[model samples]
Target: MTDLSNAIWRKSSLSGSGNDCVEVADDLPDAVAVRDSEDIQGPALTFESRQWSAFVSGVKRGEFDLA
Candidate 1:
């Protein structure tokens, strides 16, 4: 298991007032941690840095866009 004791999580600045966003912690050595803003103590998903970058790129390109 990854040691998240020192993780610093941050939410998107574009998010609205509703707690309907996710927070990310990229301070880990080799992985990025993501957790729901509504559930701080909930389960977190860990992804490789490269994988996260690719995912972000896809998001920027609207590859996951839905009508």
Candidate 2:
């Protein structure tokens, strides 16, 4: 498991003060971490940097959007 003790988590500006969004921390070397904003003490999912980049790209392309 990746050590994210020092991870700086941030939610999207679009979240607009809601506690229902996911938070992301991309400052870790070679890794990115995501966790539920409403559950900061819960487990976080970590991803390889490249993998996270690809996922972000897919999001930008609406690959995961509901039809």
Candidate 3:
């Protein structure tokens, strides 16, 4: 399991506008952690390094729309 005790999570700056933005923690040795910014005590999702890379690429390519 990922050790999130020291993980640093950050949400989008626009989250102040009341959007339910998700927060992500980088710097994990082999994976990335994601969770709902609005629910800090909620369950988190972990993704392998490679999978995270692909997901990010897809986001940049507009395959997913944040809006």
The lDDT leader among the candidates is 2
Arranged by lDDT, best first: 2, 1, 3
Cα-lDDT of candidate 1? 0.94
Q: After superposition, how far is residue 30 of candidate 2 from its true place, in Å?
A: 0.3
| Estimated TM-score for each candidate | 0.91, 0.95, 0.82
Q: Write the per-residue lDDT of candidate 1 for residues 1-67, one digit (tens) a residue.
A: 8888889999898997878999999999999999999999899999999999999999999999998
Top of the candidates by TM-score: 2
Q: Which of the two, 2 or 3, has more TM-score?
A: 2
In angstroms, how far off is 33's CA in candidate 1? 0.6
lDDT of 3 by residue, 6-48 (tens): 8889887877877489999988888899998778998999999
lDDT of each: 0.94, 0.96, 0.89
**How high a TM-score does candidate 3 get?**
0.82
True lDDT of residue 16, candidate 3: 88
| CA error at residue 29 for candidate 1, angstroms | 0.6
lDDT of candidate model 3 versus the reference:
0.89
Structure candidate 2, residue pairs in collision? none
